[model samples]
Target chain A: MTERASFREYHQNIIERVATRLEESLPAQWQIPSSLREAMLYSLMAGGKRMRPLLVMAACEALDGNADAALDAACAVEMVHTYSLIHDDLPAMDNDDYRRGKLTNHKVFGEAAAILAGDALLTHAFYLVARLSQVHGVPAEQVVNITMDLAELAGPKGMVGGQAADMEGEQGLTELSQLEYIHLHKTSDLITFSLLAGGRIAGADEQKLEALRTFGQKLGLAFQIQDDILDIVGDEAKLGKKTQSDMKQEKVTYPYFIGLEASRGEVERLTAEAKSAVIEAGLADPSRLLEIADYLMNRDH
Target chain B: MTERASFREYHQNIIERVATRLEESLPAQWQIPSSLREAMLYSLMAGGKRMRPLLVMAACEALDGNADAALDAACAVEMVHTYSLIHDDLPAMDNDDYRRGKLTNHKVFGEAAAILAGDALLTHAFYLVARLSQVHGVPAEQVVNITMDLAELAGPKGMVGGQAADMEGEQGLTELSQLEYIHLHKTSDLITFSLLAGGRIAGADEQKLEALRTFGQKLGLAFQIQDDILDIVGDEAKLGKKTQSDMKQEKVTYPYFIGLEASRGEVERLTAEAKSAVIEAGLADPSRLLEIADYLMNRDH
Candidate 1:
């Protein structure tokens, strides 16, 4: 099998393990504010590929930290990602009616409830992070650093900036650089934070962490490009999200700017740079991260 | 002048100090996501009464912490409050068009920027907390504790819950207890956090902090009641916000259930309880706090 196929299987297995653990960590459904808890779980457990958290785990493991030690950090990052998706799909934003082939949170739970659910999830994300420092027996400094990075990435300088830029694009932007601006904020920043945070949790030093950041940076761009490619080529049923919505909305995308083929080439190039950086970090074991970098570009859904 | 009017002047002074400090801390305009920054500043600096932060400062002073050291905490709480107001006024939410006698954030900055500004302000609130720990020479553990408290107040079980309940009330809540439920989540929780976090910064002992929590609980309820009364009797120009909109919306308020006179009495009773707590804390100077609490019921706004 190609490196991409085998890596997909490996990531799939790890993500399932993490997801199961997350479910166990939550306050029992009954203890939660029934309707609000349901909305959080519905979006949280609906199960994306768990890419961000998986990055956190893989980076920690690569950096010689116990993957389990970073579990809550991993979960928190995923939770933040989930909350953004929930809010982003609200009628006032993307007005998305569906996500992951299921009705959007706002669609099922009403706009106010969905918005509150998103706020709750985001808040819970930090709660988990704070709790993790206590439970994982890590340095408070590490927890603080990890939390700060997560907050910044999930906040204005990162994903929120991207979302704003993306929203602006719906009004039709004339510049291709603006498309890149959107991608950097919307996708690349958090992906970069995910890997670096995992390393920090493991006590990875500055030099090593720097290399891993370069790796994550390239990987995120590749991943977003791959997303554009998938929307063009992958099966809608399998992907479980709407296809051609970008085109339909006249939203800017790599595919729209560079054409599908050029975007395809960019992903391939980014994948190579990403893999090389991981190899340079000397942080990975048994070629798994290198393999995963290859696989990120190959994800079809 | 009555003791209450005397106290109002004290609250007004504290309000001015906070406003001056916050505006001075900010560049006339910060360029990082300039539009969102503008939105946050517009809402936060738009002539707010500074009641929450004053409570925080007062509680800190009562416990032997310098009110100056509490600046970041004070500002952080206000930012969170402002973020909520911005979101609460969104087209997808309450959709009101005015705040503090000016256009709401969404009305001024466009909906997407408004949403983003709210998210940024919320995130920045935490950012400020983390930085405050350093700037104020607060112990790391104390800083972490305050951060956690701030997060909780803003999160699912606290302010967000209040917002959710408020939303549900629009669909019509039949039970008076449900309206209290709304107040607890929406108003009381943040108020509680405001006072509690202030004490935490000051290193208040458990007994004193707990007492202030009691004070805050009463004050929060009274504060909301006063707000309800203001909606009925407040002059629009004096309130610096739209005054007549709430009753027109047919939404519930404390006066809507208990009648205006009862709500006024409740505010007076609660304000007295709050003052007693400050005195009980046994601070070197309880004058400022006493002044603020004594005047709680008399604001035309």
Candidate 2:
């Protein structure tokens, strides 16, 4: 096989693994109300790039950790990501009718179910991490630490805080720094969580974990800037929603503050910084992490 | 002071402690967005009976556990309870303009802020529990257990599931069993979490934990039935809500199925059974729990 074909297969393998685990993440034996279960699964099973989960597994793999052991953490990050998307699409929030090329949770299940589903997903993500000790024999201290980090990164001062700022910015974004704050917390915090969690699962030291955090932060910002660029210049069908929806909603983005060319340059700079952080950390294997960083930088969607 | 006055003082002490902790619970050092923090604290500090946090402390005390050690768990349970109230009062949910004698969260903060505030509270609740190990020196294993229980009891198959069923039931009247299911999950699960968490914090064994579970299930159901009863006969001034509002909403309740007299009798019966379980467990001191049960039973609003 060609070198590119081999890389494609490696990436595809991780995606399939994450997808299957996520599909099976919700407990079937528990008496989950049918409609609630359906609403949660509908948006969860709806395919996205699975970017957050992929970052988790890749970070773990870079540490020469067992990717299988990191699978639950991988899925947990995605669950948080999915819940955010569901809530972000609520009528009270963005009121988007579609996500990942499919109808948004509230659009399909109505607002109440949508709200509950988002809540359930967020709650369940913590449950998965807590189970890591019992299921994967991760140390109790590590589990506690991982759980704490997940909550912090996703909680009020992190992703949710970012979301609140984003909504406030909707009225009128005053400065570039305000827009960056929204992206960092709303988008970057959880991505940072994915990498740090994977590193924790792999028993990486504090210094290595710090590296992962920096890498995740830079990469997340780059990915988000690329999203803004795509919104203005990309194809609608491939992008899964209407292009220029951000402009229509009057949402201020990176490209809005800085021109498209500057935004693209920012993505490239951030991706390079992200890869450099991982490489300097001297992980067991950094090839996959570096490759993923480059892939995120150039992705059309 | 008279015996009644002393009892009032005792309850007041616990409430004051929990209220102070909750007021300080949001990490001031963290970069929580100002408006989001205000929205969260608004609903949280809006006083209720403090029933759930009281249960956590009371149950911990019953097992000779240091109430101080259990405070974080107590605050965490109240956070979950408060978040549920915020979301339940949303425009898409109960659509209430008032809660606890003040404007509801969505009414005060707008729908988007209310939703994000609720999300922040829920996520923060887990963060608090995860900190128990660090703050109180609770064993990591116990912290893991508490975190897992908190998620399961509060997640889809528990409180959120019951909420979904309750919303579905709004479409039409349902059988008594369906109402019971909703009551058990929506009302009972988090209460059960409080007791079990307290027991775990106190280092209680499995048998005592089971006793707490049974006690919580019975007491929680009784509490909900009492709520339904109050909806009909309650004084609006004391209740801080409209009397017969359940009827206005066409909500099916225990009184709607069984007569008011029968519902009152059921509450008494359940309270007795709940106290019996705790008494049979031979806890360090069951008096507080027993008193709390009776207080819940006789509460007018």
User: Quick one: best lDDT, which candidate?
Assistant: 2
Q: Model 1, range A1-301, lDDT digits (tens) per residue? A: 3544466576887788778876765666422356777788889898878888878888888877867767777888888888889888877777888888889998999877887788777777777776666677777766667666776777766788778767756768788788777777688888888888888988989988887788877888888888888877888888897778777777678888889999989988988888887787667462666767866777778
Q: List pairs with backbone clashes in candidate 1.
A: B162-B185, B162-B186
lDDT of each: 0.77, 0.91
Candidate 1 C-alpha lDDT tens digits along B207-246? 8777778788777887788888888888877887777677
TM-score of candidate 2 versus the correct structure, residues matched by position: 0.97
Error of 1 at B149 (Å): 0.7
Name model 1 segments beyond 4 Å from true.
A1-10, A21-33, A174-176, A284-286, B1-17, B20-31, B66-69, B241-246
Write out the backbone clash pairs for model 2: none
Cα deviation at B176, candidate 1, in Å, is 3.4
